[model samples]
Target: MAFQEETLNLQMKYFVLVKPSNSTPSCILSLSTIDNRDIYNNLCQTVHVYRSSPIHDSDSSFDIFHVLKEALSKALCYYYPLAGKLVESADDGKRRVHCNPNAENYGVPFLEATANCTLSSLHYLDNNDLEIAKYLVFDPQDKSYPLVFKVTKFLCGGFTIGMGVLHAVCDGFGASQFLKSIVELSRGRTEPSVIPVWERERLVGSITKQPFPKSPMNNVAFSPFLNETSSTVIKKYCFKVEGEMIRRLKMSLRKENENLGFTTFEALAGFVWRSRARALKLNNNGETMLSVLVGMRRNLKDFEPLPKGYYGNSCVDANLVLKVSELNERPLYEIVKLIKETKNVGSTSEYVKNSIDTWETNGKESLKMKSGGAVTVLTEWRHLGFLNENVEFGGNEVVNVVPAPCNLFASVDMSIFTSSNKFDDENDPSMKGGVNLFTSLPVDAMPRFKEEIESLRFLS
Candidate 1:
């Protein structure tokens, strides 16, 4: 595919402050767990596009902006913490949500804009054009707000919704729940089906002081705040892996190890891990790591499973490290085994409980995991329901979902987000019920990485 320059005449139309419709008490909401502080600097932004609704008359009487604004206001009543601002606590110097029910600081930042292009025009945008899409979303540098929203209307009547939520406020799953509620309200629903729960302190419980576990991968000394320089340029790539190909890969692995019952996620991640190590040309003895984000909501044994509406960070990072030569020479099944074992260690209910206990006792200063060296962070967002949310604007449901660029974070060697294919051709084997990998790599190594990924298709 050839890269084409596409211009989007995007202009900010208006800024709406979405406040809660019902009154609530004023107080500060403390982030109960230290895990919330881990992603204080990361911006989780998502963009969804919908085709123009056919219900509008020839006069274009359907006003989407007004409807969305009103619906969002109603949704804020239940998910009121989203309408609050992030402020530093004077005592602990930690950030917490200041939910002043008072009129001054109790509204979410919502921006409305228009563009000259249609949803089809966005087809020209590839992995490299993610910066353009990121600009369409609201990103606050000062960390003043927990949530910011942007809506862009196209000339062809299609529109795109861009959301930028601080990771400290909620993970992707939590954000989806909030968005679904907004959709329901937009469709004229009286109230949200699920009420949000905010018992973070009780769910996490008290911290217990104990010796931190010793793990080489988690003991890295790198920090994102440090100034680092390198000749490698950061670039992004996107690829579609067919469901059939994934099945074949898993089958081959299972044949080698009868006990191997890996999901598509494990199979694909193994391939990427090996391929990336080869492409980077790291020293044989150098350490290469793969970090996976494991959710703790369902894995908590001590506490009941988090409620459907618990909008907070409840994920723990698990890391698997191996010598570069071992990764390259090992069979694919072996790599899959390593990935599975790491997941098992992280997915255990006890592991999550211990993590919370440790973090609570030591606070943010005790976080040991650091991103640097040859580490690649993989986040699986396939089940987040980005496409199935039924988010309708002007009677049109969301047709496409595009994640923001991963190139902004330079400290990490690579960042990968995997999602189900949104645009697949009927005849294309690689596109049928497949997975799409949105990845970022150092520019100097991307060419070699592309070669490795392409080789996997034939090898499978």
Candidate 2:
């Protein structure tokens, strides 16, 4: 519906106590599969402790609707695709709207149409707890976004917010852009401090601009609402993984692969994806692919955080090749080696930016990928500054924050976000690594996956 309702004298709040900037701050965020209403409600509460607004001099200025709207707008700004400049179809006339010109104010009807298509799942909200209710305050309504955000009016004179943005939009670093922006906007700011740049053409336009990639955005091969109906039902579960555990895991893998040291993410992802592969027990010695999202922040050379600082999906996803059996049975270090080698070729932020063009010009179909095809994504967002426990709203607390699982067919998808439990070397372990997993296989998949993991236990 409306970004935020104005009736009932509604108001907005922030997790961070930022002053209303004259400009919109480019705050950002991302999510994992968190359909439970109670937890979602709790996340909506501002986790940051805010002092009395010196400017407001009174609480009258706080508008929940506006606050939530600010958050939604920034999130939207980050991944709206209106900003991406590649054309997937040719003059062959697939006759559809393409990404390159990110601005789509006229697509309001299209957004609403897509938004309305998701009415069926809305019932998931009817059963949420208060934590979930509060969480909905800033959630997004676009179903494509793994995160779900919605708005509901209350009889008492207010409304509820909902969001379910897919982690694909941007990772935690990107998400922070929106959060920062909303906080600034709520303070009554006008434009954003660091306006996000969606010039994908400049950053990563296709190598072949005349034609587009095979349109992953509009694949008829996959159904619009990718319900796991035909697949065996898989129950959802989550746990906080210690960063120390992750750090040690990386070190151990590195010791094994001294010549090709693996990053914490590669080691951990390789370990997990392989475990899941073993559980599948497929006969084919197929080539398994591990997808890692590469952030193009300042072209990877590590520029001072963009004067705009970590905004949107400045990422290029790449795959690592391994035998399915290797993924499941090989020493973690070997997998780490493979990951490092693949990444070593072109980690310059430059390649990440150029990939946009290469991908756009070459199209995904033209780029050959080795066949044995079991693709899994491996990434670590802990290093991205999401570890800061600066989220809160008024009296409410953000007990948790996670990105929903990306629904990929016949593919095992796993996303690991910075855990809320701190695990900084200096600070107490409040934030750890939280894993979000997804698959279209059977319900038996996960338990079996866990068993396969234990099969590779690294003995002391």
Candidate 3:
């Protein structure tokens, strides 16, 4: 299929300040204990792209911009913190949400624009052309609003909604919940099904009187942003791994070792880790590490499952270290075992509680420390309800959803597995039920990495 590259002529229609319809009290909201403040300190934005179905002339009266603005106002009433601005705290010098109920700083910035090109014309675009995607959303460094949105109307009567939310306010899950509420309201729902909870203090309680021992994990420094020179060339690649291929890979691993039982995430992550290790060609003595974000909402034993409305950073980082030589020589099952074991440790409530306690005791100094060695970070975004929402902008359901790469954590190599859409053919290489891997690597290493990934299909 020939893909056309068309210029999108976007003209700003108007800037709307979406405030909560109901009044809210003024206050400052602090980061939760589990919130990795140091890592997300940069002014990076998480962009979500949604493509809408074609709008017919019969529905010309349906004004998408007005509907979104009204629904957003209602949604902000429930998720007021998002509507607030991020201001640095006087005492700690850390940024916190200043949630004032008045209209001044409490409204989110919403931009409505019209584009000359249709959404279909941009189907050829992918992660490699992220600039196009970035242009669809608000400025990443724009700190005026914690959440900003841009709706672009296409000439073909289709539209796209791009949302840019600061990483400091909430994680992807929290952001998705907030977006879902807006969609529900847009659909004429009286009330949002899931309310938002803002009790971050409960997650990260006050410090204890006695000094706690420093955690071993704090020994390494934590550098989330990479020092980029003019010569540094970072490129992103998106690859789709079908469910059949994933199942076969896991089956092969279990066949090699009868005791192995790895989930799709573990198996795929291990495959990517091993491939990268080989591509980088690290020395036998050198270490290769895999870091993953583990959610603690349902796993916390001390507290009941976090309320449906609970919206905060309720996750911790887990790592697996292995010698490069061992990683290359061992069977895939062994690597899967290592990943499974490491993730299991962080799966428990006790583990998450202890991690928070350690962070509280160590304070900012420990948080500033970067990891000792280079590690590859993998963030899984599957089943986060990005496409499941009933998002209608005067048309049918969302046709395509693309999550832009998070540039904040640009220090180490990063890979994100976003959800995929369905294709017609079951055996089609681009079939649905697959995961789209958005990855970044040095220009020199990417060729070898791509080769390694392509060889997965031949796995026996």
Superposed model 2: Cα runs more than 4 Å off: 1-63, 70-148, 151-161, 164-173, 188-191, 204-230, 234-239, 254-260, 300-312, 349-354, 364-373, 383-396, 405-411, 421-441, 452-458
Determine the backbone clash count of candidate 3: 6
Runs off by more than 4 Å, candidate 1: 1-6, 57-59, 124-129, 213-215, 218-229, 299-303, 368-370, 406-417, 425-429
Query: For candidate 3, what is the TM-score?
Result: 0.87
Which structure among the candidates has the greatest TM-score?
1
Compute each candidate's TM-score over C-alphas: 0.89, 0.58, 0.87
**What is the C-alpha lDDT profile of model 3 across 1-460, one tens digit per residue?**
1122347667775566788889876887887766536666544444444444545545676677787889999998888888888777668755678887765646888888887677667762433445476566665345647788887777766666778777667777887788888888887888888888887777774455543344333223222122323244566667777666776787789899998877889999999988766665545665667888898777455665777788777777777777667778998898899899989987877666666776676667543433322467888887677766454443555645665544656453677887775221233664455777777665666688778877767767
- Quantify all predictions' global Cα lDDT against the true fold: 0.70, 0.40, 0.69
Order candidates by lDDT, high to low: 1, 3, 2
Global CA lDDT of candidate 1, please? 0.70
Which ten-residue region of model 2 has the weakest summed lDDT?
31-40
Output the TM-score of candidate 2: 0.58
Cα lDDT of model 2 by residue, 89-152, tens digit:
3543111223322243211111110122121133222221212223233433332223333343
Q: RMSD in angstroms, candidate 3?
A: 4.2
How close is each model in CA RMSD to the real structure? 3.9, 10.9, 4.2
